[model samples]
Target: MDSIKVMMDIYKEDRSMKFNIFVILILSLCASLFAGTADDPNLIGWWNFNDGGAKDWSQYGHHGVLRNGARVVYDTERGMVLHNPKAGYLDPNEGHSGHVYCGGERASIADPCTWADIPRSYTVLMWIKSQMWWTPPWPGSPNQFEKEWQAIFTKGTRGYGQLIITTVGTQGRIYFRARGLQPSTNDHINGNTFIDDGNWHHIAAVCEYDAVTGQTALHLYIDGYEEYNSPVIATGSLILCSDPVYIAGSYGGSTKDGEIYMDDVRLYNRALTESEILTAMDEPIPSDFTGDSKIDMDDFRVLAKDWMETDYTIASDTGGMVAHWDFAGAAGETTVPDLVGDNDAVIVGGGQLDGNGAAVLTGGPDGPYIDLGANLGNVISDLEYCTIFIDCVWDGNSTSWQRLFTVAQPGTTEFSTITYVSVNERWLRYYQRHNAHDEETNASNPTYVPEMKGQHQIAISITKDYGLYGCTIIYIDGVKAAFHTNLAPCSLDLLGQTSRNYIGRGPFERDPLDANTINIDNRFAGKINDVRIYGRRLSERDVKDIYEGVSRQLYFKLEAPGNLSDAESTNSKVVDFKDLAALVNKWLQQVPLLEDNLN
Candidate 1:
């Protein structure tokens, strides 16, 4: 009886062990099916180095040749790594100390490892670690790459058609170079992040040719965050050269005599999305907890519930804003919603929306104007000070009086107006009729007038004192253009008047014959992008910050004075008479008038 009992216990233990093994295998299969996959369709080449040889893991069979003492080694942090130790080639003239050639000797586009194989939109990704810091001996102390650069990877020849990535300076600043189409179209970009602090980092470079803009955009991302992006014109096909793709060093007659480790190099035929890049930064998770393949809300909620069962609120950055009008509403909508306050605007007359989503006016007698209701017009009565800001662009044809903003009392001519007086100049005209008293004041700056032909930012600040009249300061594009003190006393009583407040138009005047007759002759032409009203006077820095926050674009036309190429021969850094003459010539060649009003 004792032997039978012992045999039953042994049988039960073996059965339990087998059941556990089966459960583990099922979970592994589930994880593989649901988690992020490394076999992306756009993947052109992948080298994990786990095979302990210079072999390609992808089915394309683009194997590499490890030369000049480069070897693979096992790493605890990063599995298999290509280790390139210092080979003592300190001179710049000496060739690369050690490197791995992705393509065999005398490789070209016809064979492999060239621009012809890569698509117009492509991405390069890898994990790298620098074991030592070595500054190259170049013209610029730490930045320029005349000869020596610790090359991470490179393709194509030196000048014509090439893409090279290298580390410069002791801080391990990343540098990139590429040339496509014209030789002058060669582009160079650099990163500010330092990765040489003896730590591992994931780096990705995405290059795409934009068909709409006819330009190429290159973006660099480190640790799943975009670090830099720039657009350059690429007019033709990239050059295909017979240079082998070099890893860890370059064959450009310079030696990267520093130890570096690289692992899990990947090349893609298309630019990977930001989420995909983030997934490549880590091992696949067991399940798609977020459902988006990203650690978003769903995953965060699970993590929070497991760690800490507490609720939290995230504060927004838009505090202390009284009234903000972004004007991002739909086209032809009569009502423009205010972002912050209850003061919405009603579009009147022939106001229409533009392609850029700004309200447009045709410089006509009955142009489009926005009317702020009576309730919001009276809100200013509760404050002792106020600031008004507007971003506007004038139509060059508007030489007559144009009112940008106005506050007035209905059934009477009592009002205050901020007007644009002339084409070559701008001034503020203030008038008020209260308690049977008529007062008027104006301010202007002769030396500096608001640029009427381009986009401009206008700001006005007013402060009212109990015993003295208020002070008014007007700013144009963050610069003080006009100021007046002790001119006229502001009345809280006038603000309370149940009159219509208007933007892009002056006071409402009625004809005696018809009470509903409205004169919109003072309506402003062009477009108004953003408007804001603060309950208190803002500092100069605050005004400047608001102006800088608005998006702006500038274009420069380059012309040849004596000879287009010879204009830059005087000094590489300074703009001399030749540059000015070239600019003048370019300006003369084009029509001497503004195009499309304000852009």
Candidate 2:
């Protein structure tokens, strides 16, 4: 029967009135669903060290701060981990710092750093991989790396108890030591396996102490299994000192000359069983594939519908291009054509076409530089938003500024308005100045990776609304690392008086007033792959696709809910005969939900 006819029958037989209010019930799941909800209640401190930071994931926030070059860096294979690079810092507990400091301030009712001091029984666990080598025979101070037994975790600077590494280099094993019985005497335990072979090993030390009898039992676990046990019953309590805790490098101790990576530092209030320890290592399941409760056939149903459908798109926003320099030319050819615009650039000084579609520029003063003509002037003069991408390799000049490309006033002796980009082994500066109003952006990640090595994609985008609401974004490879706004209000103007642009040269140490001087130079020495200038700011998604390459990805979509199988009314009841009839009518039909990916 039709919905209208059913309504008429219901109106005629008005003896029974019904009201059914449908509600959506949502499930509140914690971020640690893979971690097992059973473990969180006992977890005093948990730091996964993913997403490039050491923020405590427990209900109690005991965030750790990075000090002395102790960086939270991302590796393509290892994800995010704490990287403590070699011992070059000045000693007496060192300089060129390499540690994550968890202060002793009581943040929660039972602070993770403080509770160990009042402990009954607990477990300290972490995962570490070493790139350390044996460079013993100390020079001046022991604060410099004199041994491979660098500390991983300790209560105070070598205070109370610690879980450290023993032996040297590739044959290193786990060691746990703490003060016991007397203030001077200490009790210790060691693991059986040598873990310094550049592989991540999960290590845990458990202390079971009986205060009544003053007896303490120490146990060590490696990769979810018990590897060592010591039945040393001591008279004194396990002394947890008053100083703050350090991860990766001990307070006033040594670290690997190479990177010693550590992650997922967790502290538990009680001794966890072998089974619970394994549960803690569970990988998180990505459940938001389609923004639904779980990933099922419904998620892929749209993908199977049509091959021509374009639901997913990762296209480059190359539509509003201002200037593009491919630097394609043969030897003795002075001109490099601007692919987007007709204005071609003239090569000055010693520059050669590498025959591989790239330009290899010679370094220092009197180096090679491509002088871009009026090609970008027309578009950039009226431009409010600008996005630029430079694909280049670093030639390693950390002492002075080395330019990637520069755009400034041509004939003016005094350097005022300019737009410049620089990349060296240690620094990256994306600067824009309009009438001396400067705006600059730097890479936000701990490791300045974009120009530290081989040919990589580095992008800087300036976005603006109608008002002064805008920011500059820095993208390394494809990830947005920084979104910065200039300290003073800025205007985006690349061509102030007349545009004079050059590749592989900077104006920082040039003539006293003029940045376009050839007299003194801070010219770049690297190979230039390509350079792009867009009139409009490119979106983060587009920058990602530009670097990763847009491919055919299936775009799955679904219609609004409550369509049911057949019952086609807003207030249709679930237990109705019409619903069953409608369900049977479309029993074997396929759903048209997903579309194919497009650029």
Candidate 2 ranges beyond 4 A from true positions = 1-317, 328-334, 411-424, 448-453, 466-469, 507-520, 551-599
Computed on alpha carbons, the lDDT of every model, listed in order, comes to 0.58, 0.55
- List, residue by residue over 1-599, the lDDT tens digit for candidate 1: 34333323433666664344334433444345333344556665676565566676655667777777788885534545788777654334436666777863344347655432554677788888776333311111112222345778777444433666777533455766665644454365665444553456688877776677666666777766655233344545554456667777776644443468888788877867788787787753222222232222243344334234222211222323467776777777667777777888777887865647577766554667887777676565554566788888877645466778887777666666677765445555554555556554454555545555568888876655312565566777876565555445664335555466778877765354664553344578888888887665554545665787732110111111112223222222233345334433332222222111111
Residues forming the 10-long window of minimal summed lDDT in candidate 1: 552-561
lDDT per residue, candidate 2, 109-146, as tens digits?
A: 35455644535567778887766342222111111123
Winner by TM-score:
1
Which residues of candidate 1, in runs, are more than 4 Å off?
1-38, 88-95, 104-116, 132-147, 157-161, 169-171, 181-186, 229-235, 254-257, 284-599
Clashes of each: 1, 6
The TM-scores of all predictions, comma-separated, are 0.39, 0.39
Q: Deviation in angstroms for 390 in model 1? A: 32
- The global Cα lDDT (0 to 1) of model 1 is 0.58
